[model samples]
Target: MAQQYTKKMIRQVFVQMLNKRPLNKITVKDIAEACEINRNTFYYYYTDVYVLLSEIFQTELQIVIDKYNETLSWEESFIVAAKFAVDNKTAVYHVYNSMQRETLVNYIYNVAGNVMIRFVENVSEGIPASEEDRKLIASFYQCALTEMVLRWIAAGMKEDPDTVIRRIGQLFAGNIEASLRHSAALHDS
Candidate 1:
């Protein structure tokens, strides 16, 4: 059997390659070479570049979720997430500029959606939101967050993510909750 490689090793190699080149220009051979492993070994750990990309975002997102103690606000949680992306700006920009941008966008949207779903559900724990409405609410949050993050990255990731996140919180503060309630009411009626 081939020697098992740890996620840390894969991640380190991946980040190093991303720093020097675009995602599309990065071949598994490049990754293997950077990590001093064979192409087959890289394949053993990841089927393709996109899979590795998704796992990176998912891992960071999971960390954001895990850091919250259930007492903090959604803004705080979102800030944690946004900061993670900002901290990984180079890797993010490489991925964002690559052919895999669409897939990466989808993953980010899914992550944002999951976070918003938790927030909305917790906030409206006693409210009666149908499954469809709940999904709509989550989708809205996901779409909004994904677009904002993409735009932020496209603009060179110049602004502070914390500032962007705070602005988002300020902009959506009461409106999002009201919109959710209104959408749920409309669906029920």
Candidate 2:
């Protein structure tokens, strides 16, 4: 129990510090001082700051995945998945502007990929779309979603998520089923 609390405190402090400055500017000493623990304690909990950052990414990814894995509403799932970036803009931007931008991009892609895969599965529920076709459709939308999200992030995330989600939905609202049907037809032929 105490160990859990210490780890949580360290995460809180690190996120708070990250919110204020770039990831490169933050050190174990800063986290240790903020958490009221020593540098060694920080090391005892984490090997390095990147490891802590990786854990944070993994935790957030898992949360989003678990919460929306079976969720059929793609738009709703996407908006909620993007909540962390919109909420923690500062920390996200700091990382985005750092050499670790790949990590952030990969995280976004993974979230988008999961949402797209699940959404496609639900949408093609009754269709005779082959597994390969379903996955191809999912990959198509996932790439589109990932690119839009990365562009949004690069542009400082000034747009509302609802509007973005709506635009995407509108653009491809019936396309998934249409694609699935087309694929099924091709497969049948």
Candidate 3:
């Protein structure tokens, strides 16, 4: 529990620092000073700032996943996730614009993929969908959502979260059902 507390403190400091400036510009010394911990203490929890950033992404991704797992509604889950980004615009924008963007992109892809797969599974419950078909469908929607969110961030996240969520909800409303039915039909034949 103490370790967890320390790690959270380190992450909190890193996030605070990240919001203030770019990741590359913020060094281990900066984080250590902010956290009031020694450099070695920071190293004890993370190898470097990049690793710390990756862990932050992973932590947030897992939170989104856990929330989705509970409700299994992509719309609600996505809105919740989007709200996180919207609320932490400075932190998110810093990461998005930083050299560590690939890390953010990869996290987006994985989270999008997981959300898509869970959504398809929930909608297709009782329907038999081959694993391959499920993967293909999930990948398709994952790419679309990931690209859309990336574009939104690139545009400075100017759009309201509701507008973005509503637009995406509209685009994908019937598509999942259609794909599930098509997959089931192909399996029957």
Candidate 4:
């Protein structure tokens, strides 16, 4: 419990610093001073600032995943993710424009991949596609979604998530199951 609290405190301080400045500009000393913890305490919890950033990304991704798992709607899941990025605009922008952008991209890819896979599986419930086919289709959509979200963040997240989600829903409506069926047919033929 104490360890968890310390980790949380370290994360909080890092986030505050991230919002104020770029990831490259922030250091372990900054986090330790801000958290009022010693450098060894900070190092004990995290190997480096990047590790801390990765933990933050993973924690935030899990929260989004858990929330969407309950609802089980791809659109809603994306909205949750978009809202998170929008809510953390300053911090996100700082990271997005910094050297650690690949870290952010990786997190987006992973979370989006999981969400897309679950969505395809749920929607294609009655379809007879192989597991490989499902994964391929999910990967296709995951790349699209990840790129879209990255572009949205790059554009300062100006567009409303509801508008974007609705447009995406219209654009991809019925496509996952259709693609799955088509792939299954091709494999059998």
lDDT per residue as tens, model 4, 1-189:
999999988888888888788888998888888888899998898899989989999998888777876455788887776665766788999989988899899988988887898899887788889898899999998999899888988888888867887799888788998999997898789
- The parts of candidate 2 lying over 4 Å away from their true place are 69-72
Using lDDT as the measure, which candidate wins? 2
**TM-score of model 2 vs. true structure:** 0.94
lDDT of 1 by residue, 48-150 (tens): 9778887887787788778865686667877777775666678788888887888678767866876888887776666676767777787788888889888
Could you tell me the TM-score of candidate 3?
Answer: 0.93
Q: Which wins on TM-score, candidate 2 or candidate 3?
A: 2
lDDT of each: 0.77, 0.87, 0.84, 0.86
Candidate 4 has its poorest 10 consecutive residues by lDDT at: 64-73
Model 4 misplacement above 4 A: none
Model 3 lDDT per residue over 16-115, tens place? 8777788778999988888888999999989999999899888888888877764557877777667667777878888899888999888888888878
Residue 107 in candidate 2 has what lDDT? Answer: 87
Residues 47-97 of candidate 2: C-alpha lDDT, one tens digit per residue: 999889888888788888888856447888888888888888899989999
Winner by lDDT between candidate 2 and candidate 1: 2
Candidate 3, run of 10 with poorest lDDT: 69-78
Could you tell me every candidate's TM-score relative to the true structure?
A: 0.84, 0.94, 0.93, 0.92
Name the runs in model 3 displaced over 4 angstroms: none
